[model samples]
Target: MKFLLVFTLVSFIISFLSDRNKTFAGTKKGLKMFLGLLPTILNVLILVSVFLYLVPKETLIKILGHNSGWLGITIAAILGSISLIPMFITYPLAAILLKSGVSYRVLSVFITTLLMVGIITLPLETKYFGIRASILRNILSFIGALIIGLVIGIFL
Candidate 1:
């Protein structure tokens, strides 16, 4: 993480030196985008925190543990599809789930579907890509996520 921060800083400095106006404009735009997404990010984080607090670890293990099998995978996929978490939060949350005894297969499917399919963003996607295309993409992604999870289960 430190290396990434240093690398990004160096890249930004170089870009600024090469084209000050454009670099500043780009930075401003990026900041604006981040701010725009901040509220949604915070809401997801708060909900996740509350959920983790309210739900016991034993319950989570029962649902997502190694023995959970197909049931766990289905639950994870459904949750991932409906969630609107940021990528940054998803990874850390995955780590927490793993530590709480979630199976790798389940985590794989959860992460894949969370990243690939976005039911919460369906309206926006439909507006941009048309309802048919958006739904088709989501369906394909869901299938792909299942395949990926199965492969991971077999290998890991």
Candidate 2:
């Protein structure tokens, strides 16, 4: 929030000192983009809330908690792939899970997949990037994430 505030203030100052007309036009464009994304944002929020509500904490812990081992990592990857979580929320949730006894290995896999693999966004990706490229990218990301998690687990 502080960064955003600082950025906005700087932008405003730059605009005020330079071309007010262009600034207004840019701001209008930005607002329109935000408004267009509002529905998707709301849908994500609802999906996240319902997901958390439907999946019991105990079950989550049991499957992804310590002693779950490699199977836990696999499960975490799968869950992360399917869920469309925003990155801003993903890190804190991972931290909370870690505090709640989830192993680092599992969290590593979860975070990797959360950032890299996007099964839910595949259609949009394919639409823009073509189906072949999208599939290849996703497949590579999934494999790369697993490798990264395994490497991190080994090191830490």
Candidate 3:
């Protein structure tokens, strides 16, 4: 976390020093991006709280707490691929998943799928990258995620 803080500080200072001509615009863009993410962040927090309340911790931990094996990995990947979650909020969801005892291998595959292929973004991706190319990319990503999950399981 310290690295993140230092990185942010350095970026701010660098942007401030070099972009003196359009500092206001830069700050405005930064603020707008932050503001744009607020709604998603709030929603994630609410969801996390609700999930923790509704689901028993021990049951969750037992199901996901590292012993569920291949079933958990498959489920995580499928759900992750179908879910239309933004990158910014995935980490917190990840934390919750981890706490619930989900294996790191499953988490890895799930996260990989979440970023590389989104069901909600399929149309956009197809439009931007062509249908065949998008399909190929998603297929390859799915396979790669599965392989990586197994690798993580083996090593971990």
- Candidates in order have lDDT scores of 0.87, 0.82, 0.81
- Stretches of candidate 3 off by over 4 Å are 127-132, 153-156
Q: What are the C-alpha RMSDs, in order, of all predicted structures?
A: 3.4, 5.1, 2.3
- In candidate 1, which residue ranges exceed 4 Å CA deviation? 82-101, 117-140, 153-156
Model 2 score (lDDT): 0.82
In candidate 2, the residue pairs with backbone N, CA or C atoms under 3 Å apart (3 or more residues apart, or in different chains) clash, namely none
Candidate 1 collision pairs: none
Angstrom error of the Cα, residue 96, model 3: value is: 3.7
Judged by lDDT against the true structure, how good is candidate 1? 0.87
- Write one digit per residue (lDDT tens) for candidate 2, span 28-92: 99899878877776776677568667877777677777668777988889998888876656765
| Residue-wise C-alpha lDDT for candidate 1, range 15-54, written one tens digit per residue | 9999999999999998998898777767876877788789
lDDT of 1 at 144: 93
TM per candidate comes to 0.70, 0.62, 0.83
Better of 1 and 3 by lDDT: 1
Give the better candidate number (1 or 2) by TM-score: 1
